[model samples]
Target: FFFIMNLQQITREKHTYMLQTGDLRQELKKQEGYVEEQRESLFSRLVELEQSAADYCEQIGNFHTNCLQTVSSMKQNRESATENATKYQQTVEDLEKWLSS
Candidate 1:
């Protein structure tokens, strides 16, 4: 249909960008300025990305340390509780033996 015909017609036309001889120097100057600007922008973005990565790494390290500490405390509490229970049972047996005598 018209869509297919238009596609063929557009391809027939040549793409052109004419840089005049007199304007060459000005164009080159503008290109150099643009390249410099892009370099600065890219450098700043890289620094920001690196800083963000460092911050995230620090936070992850802190979380890992906290988890280890919590686990260790939990283990200690379990051991203490077990020891206390064993002591209480021994006391109870001693009292029963005395009553029977």
Candidate 2:
């Protein structure tokens, strides 16, 4: 009778352990699902951030190109003005020489 009781006690312990293991597994599964959801949300946010950075880069490139074009235009205008001034100076000198003669 003691042996029988001992065997029954062992069986009960085994059953209890199995139930605890099953509960732990269920909790682990829930945690894994929660972690997966967080990972997906972070990945989506990363993608959006990358897209926004790309847009900013494109805008900066466009602005840089526009600035270069404006500088070039200003340089050309300055050169043209300098050339005109030199020609006018030469005309004035020739007129002075004629008047002195």
* Number of the top-ranking candidate, with TM-score as the measure: 2
lDDT of model 1, residue 3: 95
Give the count of colliding residue pairs in each prediction: 0, 0
Best prediction by lDDT: 2
**Judged by lDDT against the true structure, how good is candidate 1?**
0.88
For model 2, the local distance difference test gives 1.00
| Candidate 1 pairs with clashing backbones | none
- Name the runs in model 2 displaced over 4 angstroms: 91-101
lDDT of each: 0.88, 1.00
TM-score of each: 0.64, 0.74
lDDT string for model 1 (1-101, tens) is: 99988877766542222335437778889999999999999999999999999999999999999999999999999999999999999999999999999
Worst 10 residues of 2 by lDDT: 12-21
Residue 30 CA displacement from its true place in model 1, Å? 2.0
